[model samples]
Target: MTIPAATASFHGIWPALLTPLKPDLGIDLHRFGLHARALVHAKGCGGVVPFGTTGEGPSFSVDERRDAVDALVGEGVPASQILVSTSCAALPDTLALTRHALAIGAHGCLMMPPFFLKGVSDQGVIDCYRQVIDGAADDRLRLYLYHIPQVSGVGLSRKVVETLKRLYPQTIVGIKDSSGDTAHTLALADAFNETLMVTAGHEPDLPELARRGSTGAVSGLANFMPHVVQRLAGRPDAPNTPHDVSRVRLLLAMLGPYALTPALKGIMAALSGEPGWLRVRAPLVALTTDQMHTLQHALKPIALDVDVD
Candidate 1:
């Protein structure tokens, strides 16, 4: 299947970056920019996604998010290589962030449906997205619909995706399936991989999705194991597929026992040797000392190389 010209540039491994915070829980822009640049330059990621689920998007206010994006761009990570997560509980906030991303020349914006409410009708979901597109009113906008039903309490349905694509083909360029269900991820690839860039958030599904012509991921695992994910998504024929898959599964298993954001931060702390990575914003606490110790022990056996400085 041929990828649409509009979505062609959105392929490859784009790590959903782990935002580092100061001890006061404010965003550490210096650390954040350095990490994003490292992922793209040193780790060979296609790009970096800021304020994603792994980065604790909803935890920060609109101002905080905007400042961080500006700082990242100011620090010399090309704006065109950054995909900003503009999802917010409110339509206005989402619009503001989306516009800001476009203003900065970001590669695209990744947005989820209005997740504050549950069991919303498909039309309602469609309308919410419609308003965002119409509200932003930017021809430069390239949007990737986010689908993570487990965390957001809402999921983007096929009908919703179809309707949005029909209404805004140029703007609605792709879908990020973080569903974690292999069947659903594959089905999405089967249905829309030709027209839209269908990306799996789950690392294990990357090889199969790549087989189906889906060429990229907005991956949490890519934060730490980018080369592994790059190989999985872009080099399925590489001899290391089995070993990479096993390593990803093992790392994900370590995250299973704790709050994912904090646990990933814990791993980042161990890798970078910066305890500042362990700090999380309010409503998400840092991993306990015991949890961190256990994570260290589990990761010691894996012996992942520290690629990011």
Candidate 2:
């Protein structure tokens, strides 16, 4: 079978969307749909990535993730614009979610290597992905290798990427480098920019990557600040590059002191004036009162408007 070239339509800012929850910590499908629609139709984001790291992907089970994707589509968020993060610690779960995303006609899937074991060989990583591609057995599969070593403990090496691309070129279409290392990201772009869609998950790196033909991001900051991320990814030389870069850095700095996902949720609570946004699954608690107050004060300087309805 002839492998087509990487997709051109995957370019632009796709927010790693925040998963809103109810007071009981159930997935709030109503608010979730609203946010997805707002990000694409109103905020000018290229699309939204749900159940990603920022969205607490692993915290939710396979069924919850599938149902939310269905609700998002039912509520008018086009499946073609959504990049579903179908990674799971177990191979069976990963295969199930990947098949579901393909069945729904999502633009693609963002999958990390099997993360339960650390320091696995490159061949082990390759074998893991091969199982998924072969098990999915779907010609429509368009996958982005998700590289976030700090979080996943297993990273995709250059050689591993090359081997997989060689074997499954059609299914392996792109890479999302959340390595948080500027040089590594640029290196991936340098090496694979011709044959793959290389996108940054680190917001500050957007300008530099954009200069090298990477015009997309799966950004956590875009959850509340989509326009800013979109502008940064547009062009490295855009006059507002410095300002946008600084703004993202400042906001990200606020997340440094707290658990990242909760800190982001706290900000969302403030932005939307809905305290329910503070709810997180177990093992991840909501921000404290003082923390919320501090976050609100920190955000006051940026004057961010609430774009999600």
Q: Give the least accurate 10-residue stretch of model 2, judged by summed lDDT.
A: 1-10
Model 2 spans > 4 angstroms off: 1-5
- Indicate the TM-score of model 2: 0.96
TM-score of each: 0.98, 0.96
In the range 1-309, model 1's lDDT, one tens digit per residue, is: 798887777778899989998877899999899888888877877888999888999999999999999988888789988999999999999999999998889999999998899989999999999999999998889999999999999998899999999999999999999989999989988999888999888998899888899878889878887887888899887788888888888878877889999998898888878888899987888998898889999997675645757
- The candidate that achieves the highest TM-score relative to the unseen native structure: 1
Error of 2 at 218 (Å): 1.0
Q: 1-309 in candidate 2: lDDT tens per residue?
A: 111355777877898989999877889999999999988988888888999888999999999999999999989999999999999999999999999999999999999987888879999999999999999998989999999999999999999999999998788888999988999999998888878888888889988888888767889888888888888898679887898888888877877889999999998888888999999997898999998998889888876634756
